[model samples]
Target: MRKTITRIMIPVVLACVFLAGCGTLAPNYTRSAPPVPVSWPEGPAYPATALPAASPVLSEMAWRDFFSDEKLKALIGLALENNRDLRVAALNIERARAQYRIQRAELFPSVGASGEGSVSRLSESLSPAGKGETIDQYGVGVGLSSYELDFFGRVRSLKGRALEEFFATEEARRSAQITLVSEVARGYLVLAADRERLALARQTLTSHQATHDLTRRRFDVGVASALEVRQAQTSVDSTRVDIARYTGLVAEDENALSFLAGTSLRAELLPDAPVNSVTLLDEIPAGVPSEVLQRRPDILAAEHRLKGANANIGAARAAFFPRIALTASAGFASDDLLDLFGSGTGTWAFAPRIDIPIFTAGSLRARLKTSKIDREISLARYEGAIQSAFREVADALAQRGTVNDQLTAQQSLVEAAADSYRLSEARFSKGIDSFLNVLDSQRSLYGAQQNLISIRLFRLNNLVTLYRVLGGGAV
Candidate 1:
């Protein structure tokens, strides 16, 4: 028993010691240079931004601080807790971690204990003693069957690949969270803007309704013409149509917000103020392209996947060499049941195997080629992710640089339209100008008010999108 134990234990101990300290054949990973310019583009559309040199990156900031509105923050918090896409992403991380552990286990031997018994009838002619006999054999042993010796680091490389994949999964969850927050913010803003539009529609409806009633009274007394009364009625009818449209739009916005929040939202959590009341950070600086590549979760996830592909290439390269394994067992052997554990019953075994690929019909080469191609593909994807991120930042910056100018111009247009409506009404009341001028001015004013609401909505949504593309996320 002692000799058998030594035979089995010595090699197992040595394999474990060597395998634990071994390194993989995978090529060292080095990130390629970014595919975009080092600095943001210079143009009229690109905003010139000034920020403190020590200003934190968006990813490092807590999301609560990024948004100034309590209602939006509450809604975002609920979505983070209940979102299904995020739940799936979290589960994927767990699965990848388990897979990595399974791959890591390949670096060790699996030992097991077993007992066996065999009974056979020997024919007289076949027996060595030339007599019929019934034979019984019994043994108990500890054994390992075909345990691989990862001398070439193939197993370690596979483990490394699994680990990188796990990291990629984690980053993917982060990216999903960032996107969800942005979507929710934008949805809330849309709901708020729609509510404002509905309010404006109601105001116009009441104003035009009052004017239509006054004109009808005047026409009954033969003071206002029939055409003037019809014109007033037209304005009131058009506003009623707008009121219906905006009311429907408000309901749809709430529905979209509910979906984004992952549950039915309480009335208290819904937008109750105009979009202009919600505030975000000042337009962020487009510091450089590196900020996006280093901070964005989607880009980071792509980078991890690229590193994993590189690890896969190392494993594929290791497969071309011979595979070495060990099969060993130690036990007691006896034919007589009474002498099964008697003296001199100890037994041992050891088998070392080497499988050199003599011929594989090019399967090995094909796998190697496939792995290399996968690496190239991962590289392209990583770079593509970087490019996409840069473009998003650029697009957001373009709007950031010019949004204020557009808002100012729209405001001026509203003031002018409002003044024209007031003067045209006064002229119609004084019997100087036709009532058509009053109708035209009222329509212009309503259109300008609606457009102002749209511009405010655009500004708020752009801010949220900027935060997302810049890697600002709380969860």
Candidate 2:
């Protein structure tokens, strides 16, 4: 039985190996270049920065190195591990890999073994002997069912398509990881800004309360007017209102941060440094080539899909040819169970079936056309992804170029407001100016400080944005 099986299987294995080398009808794959300019845009918004000969590869830099704050780094780490979106992306890669394996298996035979036994009794004139007779039979065999021989590379093309799709899924996971890192950093910055605002509000409230107390003492001595004392009380009440608003804002920020962390966070992971104090990431070196966008996982994923589409076209073309399947088995069989494996009981059978497409009413042509169209669509999508990435980088550059100026001017305004507030207070004490001047200066100073925090937040966020648009070095 063993020799008989080997005799039947040798030819089948050789045929599979030989025909698999027969090239696929799918057009030779050539990577398409991005439909974008070779260099980044330059103008007032995008300042030209020269690239050094040893410019570090941005894609190779780790996120930890990009973000300087240890606390923010820790938060990003937690998010990468626990974020639901990232986890889903990872699971999708596993599923795609399984699908690829399944497709690849089609290139070989599906071998199996089986055993059978039967007992029957016959009694009738229809029987050769007009009397009753009993019969028993048993058999065992090892064989392979129908397995397609890829003479035209139909199965191979399908396997190639599955492999490319698997690669695309892996890139998708990388893209998701990049997005998660950027989001966590942005959330941390937002929380810090709110906390700083809350602190500022509290300080303002205390100062207003002290001024109100001094005005009341002056009124008790019949030296200050009732109008001035009322105005002073108004300042205190207004500051208290601001304090309440900022206190709620801080709590909301904490909730958002916790949600991003994907679990209840300890106080240590929360932002402690003010928005300006935490250096999120170093400025991305200028003159980064447009080729860098190709490294972005999203763009790479799109290109993989395009390659898969190209494979699909080959599979469709192969469908126009005949499909040959081999189903063969070799074993031993006998009328008696005891003789099932005896020397004289060897048995074998081989069947090769061919399917020819005679009249499909243009369905084959339609399928081929559809596959070609799919390839074109994938190509367009790939190009579109490149254009989108270019636009994002340009936008980031535009905002980054101007943010420092805004921040610098805001700081100067804050300093001037503080001096004016101090002078107004001295003049009010000496009766050279009314309390309204001091109140105006205090409001201006508080507003200027708030604006400064916002600008700092924008500058930090711009850095984070540039990192993300450049693929975050998360690749």
Candidate 3:
């Protein structure tokens, strides 16, 4: 009996060993290199700062380290914890992980134990004894069913594709995290800028109100014409309208920030004044464009997708080959319940199946072609992601290069405008110039100041853009 059992198991064990060494039918995979330039584009628009030999890579930095304001840092933290988009991204990762596990399980057999008992009555016409008789059978066994032998690497390729997809999802989650940080910071900056604008409008209103009062008194004393008093009133009314508009804008900014943070923000944690200062690092080195491909999560995700598509092609190719499966069981069987596990009641079965693709009406060929096309699509998307990343970094660097010069020129213009307004006010007070001159100068000064604030905001926001494009704060 032992010899008979060993002879039956030998072929099964040999088949398992042969299948274990089977090669995958999938094509070899290699990363599609980025088609962008080796170095950053150079011109007056690009930063001229010396490339430090040992400066820390920006992408590895933490968000708290990148942003200096305590309030802004806290807000970023709050958004990271409570943001709905980020929460969804995390859940997506979990789902992908589970999916990968499910696919991987196909590479192994699932063993189980089952038991059965049955009784049946036979009619006398059908029985050799020519009488109705009852028969009983009992059985129990441990075995596996329809376990595919990976002789053509079909299951392995599928598992590989699933694993790559899981990695891609992880990268997507990282990309989502980085985007959330950038948006929170940008929203906070916008709120600060609105507050600054509101304050400027209030100050202008106060100055215009005082001037209106003076012009009215002067008209009462017959020292000023109705035209001058009316112009002064015009300035006051225009400023009051601006104040009301800006007040509404500030509230809207707060609401936007609240939505991004995914939680109600405390008043004390908010910026009280326009953002005059921040803790962003002085410089972010724009390394080679190819370097960003490795750092940017979106780009990494795209590449992973391409690899998964390549693995899928292998699976599709394997479909054209024969699939082998094995099902086996060993147990005991007897007619009597008490003799189910008796020493002489042993029973066993071994079944091996092979499915050869004889005809499919071109379905197998179509599937293989589909997988190849899908791989090509993924490759195109990966290259496009790299090109898009290059453009964003270049644009941010261009803005960085010119922002300081723009800020300097704006500051000089503001100074000159303020001086011109001061002289015009003095001349108007001494009756050397018309009231219209004072009004013109006041408008010029106010316009220059507003422009200056806008330039400052642009400069700061550009830094945020650079950080985002470089994949900073994504750890």
Give stretches of model 3 more than 4 Å off. Answer: 1-22, 119-135
Question: lDDT by residue for model 1 over 255-302, one digit each (tens)?
Answer: 988887789989999888888988877646545678667988899999
Model 2: number of backbone collisions: 0
- Residue pairs clashing in model 1 are none
Per the 3 Å backbone cut-off, how many clashing residue pairs does candidate 1 have? 0
Kindly report which residue pairs in candidate 3 clash with one another.
none
Best by TM-score: 3
Please give the CA lDDT of all the candidate structures.
0.87, 0.86, 0.87
How high is each candidate's TM-score? 0.89, 0.91, 0.92
Q: Against the hidden true structure, what lDDT does model 2 obtain?
A: 0.86
Model 3, CA-based lDDT = 0.87
lDDT of 3 by residue, 277-358 (tens): 6556667777767676689999989999999999998899989877889899989899999989888999889998877799
